[model samples]
Target: MSLKVLSALDVARIQLYHFKAIIIAGMGLFTDAYDLFCIPPIIKLIGRIYYVEEKQYRTTPTVVVSALVAIALLGTVVGQLVFGRLGDRIGRRSVYGLSLGIMVLSSIACGFSICRTRNCVLVSLGFFRFLLGVGIGGDYPLSATIMSEFANKKTRGAFIAAVFSMQGFGILVSSVVTMVVCKIFEATSHVSNGQIPEQVDIAWRLILMVGAIPAAMTYYWRMMMPETARYTALVEQNVLQAAMDMEKVLDIPMSQIAEDSLLPSYPPPSYPLLSKRFFRRHGYDLFSCAASWFLVDVVFYSSNLFQSQTYHRFIKDQPDVNAYELAFRVARFQAILAICSTIPGYWVTVYFIDRIGRVKIQMIGFFFMAMVYFAIGIPYKYFWSEKIGIGFITLYALTFFFCNFGPNTTTFIVPAELFPARFRSTCHGISGAVGKVGAIIGTVGFLWASRIPNNNGKPDPVRMTVALVFLGVVCLVGLAVTYFFTRETMGRSLEDNENDDE
Candidate 1:
């Protein structure tokens, strides 16, 4: 029978299975958001809890606090690069399980927070934070690949972007849980007025414990999910199974699957990627992805960390808030706004990813981000210019709105799609790891910039210049990367990429 002859009923089954995969991938993305965000409120809580024992916990210097954050983001950098490659080599499903396991274990360990007589507390918290970051790094490429593979060409961008949109959901949930936990810890905290209390009090331990919520959710997927059919087919050469999986997704026929999947007796198309013709092509796909992802991540993290300070100032100044009330409100507001951004972002990526293509959206978003971020530096240089300051901040938020709708959504989606099967997971992982470098750069750099105040008690021009330059460079590079490099991979069959490998 011809490809056109498949029953409509068969196509429906295939669609249902693919839908399930996207949701499952979304769950993993949630963990990434939760792991990154769970730290901020705890930073506040820990400060209050151990103020008197400041030396004991090394809470004495702002630098020390900043150091902890840097280490964790750095951990994500390591995880993305390292674990990502591991996933490609071993198998996507196994790595997915392993990454989730590490995340769950580290989160629970963080709840046992400490760092007193010995290095136990610091060691424990830092170790777990790092491990969780790594898990997030690995998950980035893995989940994106899974969603894209299972998605229909018509809706691939939307489905994957929606999976990523769950990142915002994770942020919103972490904020809510932290808020609730902070309030409860406050009421029973045995301390009042946002003070840490003279005793080894309730703040940090309570704050860290909320991480368990995501840990709990990890078990939800233990039964319902499997490896992406595309990954299974491409890397493992399990054509029959791959075809079966696709049939479930596209609702096609068994005979149609067999006919469609027939391997050419002789190889046809080619990806210069795997050709021995290229120097060190064996790992180039993996490393190049890592490098590009790492570069993009730094910009993303820098903008997010810097922008968050809009509210961070309030937390720093308001010491009298109820512990729970304080954490909850900040998270709620941030999450709410971010979630609002995701709704539109999800719609755009899903609707236009195929139509407009990835490069165009990424170029436009990064360009706009460069202009807006530079504007932020202007008011920082002139501290008294509150009107311009507010305007810059608003523009920055608008940039994020555009950021998510555009580059933020596409970059993650594109890398997973670009590479062939054997290298796809590893390549994406490498890309993820590279992204982590960006995150580390952003985390460390912005943590310092957040403190940049001018001689007039306003933001220093030097600091603003540095921030403007940093973001400017990121957007500029992104523009170049998308323009001179990168290709479209929206509608091709995975089967086609495989035959090229031969």
Candidate 2:
């Protein structure tokens, strides 16, 4: 038999048929990015509305912030198992629609929350974040499967990943939105007794409301896209009803199928996850996937979340700036570079995903990021930039670009590729959940590091260097893991799994 390998141009043409799926799938992603970007601004709002004397407050404790973010991740962990299992049993079509609905309802609910007490806010915040996580988690399986299953074999890696690269759009749009809303609030902000509570309702709540729109719009699309042919084929074997159901999904006649297309009927609605020999074969791959995701989360979230500090470390010494202005500048500047990093990185990934191969591009990105990380940390620690502070800022910005284009993107896409259909959602969720575990560690570590000031009464360069160096090491470790375990998936289709028995 001859081997089949697809080149880059072939990926572009094949992905065109399912372009609608790519657009709709990005809806949940936009919301995920929206929620993440909205948080820091909201954190600023919450601080102002509920400020204490400097002695009484320690900046929304990292533990608190981590819990809020991780809670959403926690929701995703549970969601993947529930919806993933359900998606397998009930069919991907209905479950995909239902997950988006949950996200919409929960996000709208969050818009109305009263964040008066810290606990009340944390609890309510956790609740909505969890709801959002569940929906985002649910999307992983459906989107990954759709992109992988439909694309022509030649460009499977690039095509499926390009679909996922829309996440950069989600994240990019969110950062921009936050900056816009912040400007709006600042312009219209009414301050009473040195506080900005009135502005919170208009700015932050409005941002939360933004999350609901994408879900509502995409509900219609998910209703229309053609279901996977593999799924239709999976059901055709048993009763005539199964094939009939697929006929409705594919809009194709049952008589047209090569009789061999159908799978034999199973005993019932489902089987134990472990019962299939397929699951047993997948054990090591699944473990690698989980490990890869966990490491990716650690490096990505840690690096991304701490960008607020890169601004501080770069400009902490300017003598003339007032505290509030410095704070605004910090938030604003980070938002801009982050957007720079986010938008182009996404577009580039979409452009090169097929050409470079997912694993190769990710490794390249991490390699570049590690270099930038050490460059910034080591230089700043030993030789701080006084004249051109922007030089250090430039290094930080480069890191963000790589983060958007590299491991961050790859980690999200890989699990989607590596798993079989039945366990894809579950494993993706597990992998994602594991990644959140890294987020928690990174968040907590940075929070603590921020508290450790040097003898000069500034954030210790040694401490910042240590944190970034540690992150670079984690990225290197992730690189080794990918090299050993992941097969190059550049020209493979998701349906390749159907031939496992061979």
Candidate 3:
């Protein structure tokens, strides 16, 4: 049990438990993505249901749309900071199930957000969405830290990225589920004179409620998971418990070393978090992770939450289509984009992350994202024109492709690996929280920036051009920060990365 001796968990080959960790941690992200992305397709439906004026439903106000989408992001910021520190202080396994519980309850509450007035409904829905966001936020750091701790160094990047890649499937499933629900309602509901049927309300509710299912299903498994060995040994100074946990999970026989015998070998107490000594060690690493995540999310969440608005112009002005049909079309388009670009980008990152290294992959992702954004922005009007609209869509999808393959995956993985065990979860939480703040900016800023004053709620091409250009600049900044400040974490044990021997 000497500190220099390789732990059984570190040397362990790929096994069933590693995959189990991925599934358990990954499912939380899947639920997070499904709940967050599902709202875009249904936002119009919510407006139609609650925002009726003069006995006819109209588009929901821009302000309301922003609130509905951004509230959860705001809550996510709170959750990440809170649960992240808690993970370090209380233990990763202790409060893990609590976050999922919040998600389940809040999702169900959001679905049943029925009230006497539109204001009441909005209040209720927004409140629950914020709570759900908190739960989703908690998943970010905990899942990454747990997976990184459990994985062997040889494939750590892939394992951590695998947990994050579930987000792609979550987004894809949201679109697919939305499409199926819209189709079901379209087929069964009566559509007299092509008016949106009342049953459409039920469809939106069903979509919101479905997010609860996956989260609830995984809660038992999350609770059953053991505290990561790194936290037990390094932070808690309980080598005996750490060895036992590793032995159980790795299914290997661990030497029964006395706790006190190994205590002297543990790394001496390090600088306190955010102290001068701590900053000297990790300040630049932290800044890079936080800034990169923030910038990526600014573009990422904006595109995701409002892509329907931007792409709605290309749906071939079907003036006669009913609301159900419109919903189905939007969901179908999103699904195609997810399958073609988003999901593939994620799995590709999973395959190559360990081979190419974290810093390089992130830089590649940011560099290309900047180029694509500028390409689309500089010729914004041309891309949106009738003859070349497909080109615009193609370029838009590519942004997502590179994003998943690049910063989106790397940002999550590196934070977990770059810091000491004591501060790993907290640092990841801070990085993710900063990213959520950027998400808030993107969701609110893009919606308002792209809205045309008198274009009946349509996105303005000129304003969208400006937004895209701004995002391109942000990506360039991310690339610069990553290249100069981010350290490579590939092929290194977590202990090695932190220089524990020092």
In order, the Cα lDDT scores of the candidates are 0.61, 0.64, 0.83
> What is the Å distance of residue 252 in model 3 from its true position?
1.7
Write model 2 residue lDDT over 247-275, tens digit each, in one string.
45443456643344333433222445555
Tens digit per residue, CA lDDT, model 1, 1-502: 2122112222233356566666667776777777567665565555544443532322223455556666777776677667667766677777777776777777766767555532466567777777777766667777877776666555666677777877777777777777666666656656655554433334456555565565456556734466555555545656556666555546566775564545422232244534564324334434434554565667777766654456654444355654455555666656655666645655566677777877777777778777776666544545513444445546766667667766777778876666655556656666666666677677777767756555644444576567766777777777777776566556554433222342
Q: Rank by lDDT, highest first.
A: 3, 2, 1
Model 3: per-residue Cα lDDT at residue 402: 94
Model 2 lDDT-worst window of ten: 1-10
User: TM-score of model 2 relative to the true fold?
Assistant: 0.83
What TM-score against the true fold does each predicted structure earn? 0.83, 0.83, 0.95
Candidate 1 residue 66 C-alpha distance from true site, Å: 3.8
lDDT of 3 at 316: 40
Error of 3 at 311 (Å): 2.6
lDDT of 3 by residue, 1-502 (tens): 3442235566678999999889889987998889877887787676666666775656677777788879999999999999999999899999899888888989999998866367887899899999988988888899999999988888999999999999888888898899898888888886743376778778888999997888788889899898887888888877777777776767666653234366635564657889988887888888988999999999898778657665567554243567777777777787889899999999999999999999999999999999999998888755553334677788889999999999999999999998888899999999999999999999888877655653554567678778888889999999999989899989888887874333
RMSD of each: 4.4, 4.7, 2.2
